[model samples]
Target: MQLMHKGSALVTDQDIGENPSVIEHAKRMGLRLITFGPHCNAQVREMGFHNGNLQIGMGSLRLGISLQSDGHHMALNAQAALAALHALGYAPAQVQASLAHWQPMIGAGQPQLLPSGICLLDHSLSNHLLSMTAAFSQLQSVAPHVSRRLIVLAGIQPGQASIDAAQLALEPLVRDAQARRVLLYGEPLRPLAAALGDLLHVNWYDDLNQLICSLLRTTHKGDTVLLAGRATTNLALAADAIRDSFSGHGGHLIASIQAPCFDPHQKQMNMHS
Candidate 1:
């Protein structure tokens, strides 16, 4: 998930749990990295990074850049995409969106691909907070059976101490618990889960390895997991490690929503390797 900025050499570090040394290399290239979780440094929040977007903090005169962020209307696009896909075939029973490192995920492979052109492209500030709000009503439409499907979210936020942005997404995600079954799990989940509820929350880290292992064992092809937050690198690497741990017995264990979107043609992220 490490992408060098297009014009100049500015690579923003998106994950906080990654090796600091590699991030230093990115810095040497004139790229700035941003962290979006509690484990991040104070300086990261000072720069305007939290959820999934990383604003290059390096002194600029730069041109066309390679920036990676999935905040704001990005959720809108997922919502629209889900709706369209539902009408098509994928018929995702439920849709949940959040900024707790887990964002909404769109699966490929045998996913019952929906129509295209329904992605969110706006990365504006004004558009970020309201992204979740706009989709809230849409989230309310699921039937009881459809709500049984759990939609998880994970990603960095756009601002610091992310209460506003988090709530923006949370308000809608938890609106339906009986039918939709929204689960909120994260490192700092006690307060959030209490404020939100078990049906809508859980302290994520409490059973991280176990939970991931369980998911790896039971998750099907059409199901998706959106991993965001912390440093993009750390989360990505963690996912990599988790996948590797399950390598060999079954088919590919990790199916990410990362881009270049993950060319299934290659069947792996490190295509260069």
Candidate 2:
């Protein structure tokens, strides 16, 4: 909060505006403030989710902006982004057009479509328990028509506090997502096997290769896999492995994992299969 000097503005959500600390800080810093949400009085407001997208509008006007993303939380993020652009003096039409093709960056809800017809939602970049739960909710909301739902979690924290939270939250989230299987890597998350043992089929892996091998063998057409955790390198390799596995038979599976290279000329990240 201290970093925000006078004349600098904070664009946030209505829910966050109610924080006493934030209110006090803004008052102290003489910070310009913009808040967005579904609240009737918010500067930017949202309508209900429809057809896998979010609709938002400025104040009480009809929702004129459509965001190509799922989840109510994501709608708030879109509103905040729009509010920031508004603060920067971008015209509403310009901002709307720019956001039309917006997609989440790699490891942040980016959906990778594989040749084998699997849609992998990568959320490994920010894989705290809260984010993991939100990922499941988003998947449930957006891709309910998918044939199979698989969840891969890597590098769960082994601390008792984390495990306890997982114990309370993991099973319900997985059930709500209607996931067919839960594949867990890293020894830290092995304890989750017991918690989810009866309601769902859980697999634990100590080796990344083994997990990749199993994933390749088991997942079929029209499946959606949600990948989330701390081992980002391992997660990227796994996603690439899945993509390359369907490219050819034997030799291609051994191909080196390709990093998501940014191609400035194309103005998008290029994924090599």
Candidate 3:
């Protein structure tokens, strides 16, 4: 890609691996390059939950990046944009100030509190592991004092690889969150259930109705529920069922839907893909 200005470029290590030639090309073109990863300049200095949002402290800012789950990738994108802006004669403070009004799009870690004091982490819209992990961590941090934690995992696609990926992604949460119970819907859960065995209170269901029934029956007040996974087909139905199931209950619901991006030039938001 040709640059209009000789600006600095920030590329994550993962991105570099995916497009090393592009990085090399950019470097050769005289762009100052900054790489971020486990050992790089884009270290997440500090991370915590504040006012029901995730706050990441980096660089010189004591009150660092504060955003919702939807802003996870956008945070990194913002960093790159900041680098470009700084190279184009904008002050660091000016760039930061411009982002003050930015907000997370829908389905990007949007939390909804139900009537029963139950909080829902709705990440059902997308199934990217990194974003899901960030959302889970944010919820875990914010609701540490909740009475119980529940996970409603959608069924993965039919394949050993899909099952394996789901297992790997969920193992940490199951162990760390100390989840009181888990309601898994779909065929991909069989192996996972077998693997978890007695370690977790897992309830597997092939039918969506049964799964929702069990979820409603088991959930109680002061509990946190995380609804996630890659159920591409029945996501909308499941969301509606859950909403109706918890209608009178005094709990909270956080439905993660794909939110639109705001186009500053157009002064409007673009639809989620």
Global lDDT of each candidate:
0.33, 0.67, 0.56
lDDT of 2 at 263: 22
TM-score per candidate, in order? 0.32, 0.77, 0.62
Report the alpha-carbon TM-score of model 2 versus the true structure. 0.77
lDDT of the structure predicted as candidate 3: 0.56
Q: Which regions of candidate 3 deviate over 4 angstroms? A: 1-24, 30-74, 84-98, 155-169, 231-233, 243-273
Model 1 lDDT per residue over 15-35, tens place: 432567756665666654433
After TM-score superposition, what is the CA distance of residue 37 in candidate 2 from its true location, in Å? 1.3
- Backbone clashes per model, in order? 26, 0, 17
> Candidate 1 regions off by >4 Å?
1-148, 155-171, 177-185, 198-203, 217-273
Give one digit per residue, the lDDT tens place, for model 2 in 138-159: 6775568634788877744434
- TM-score of candidate 1 versus the correct structure, residues matched by position: 0.32
Q: Give the per-residue lDDT digits (tens) of candidate 3, residues 164-205.
A: 666555656656766777766666655666556666476666
Sorting all predicted structures by TM-score, with the top scorer first, yields 2, 3, 1
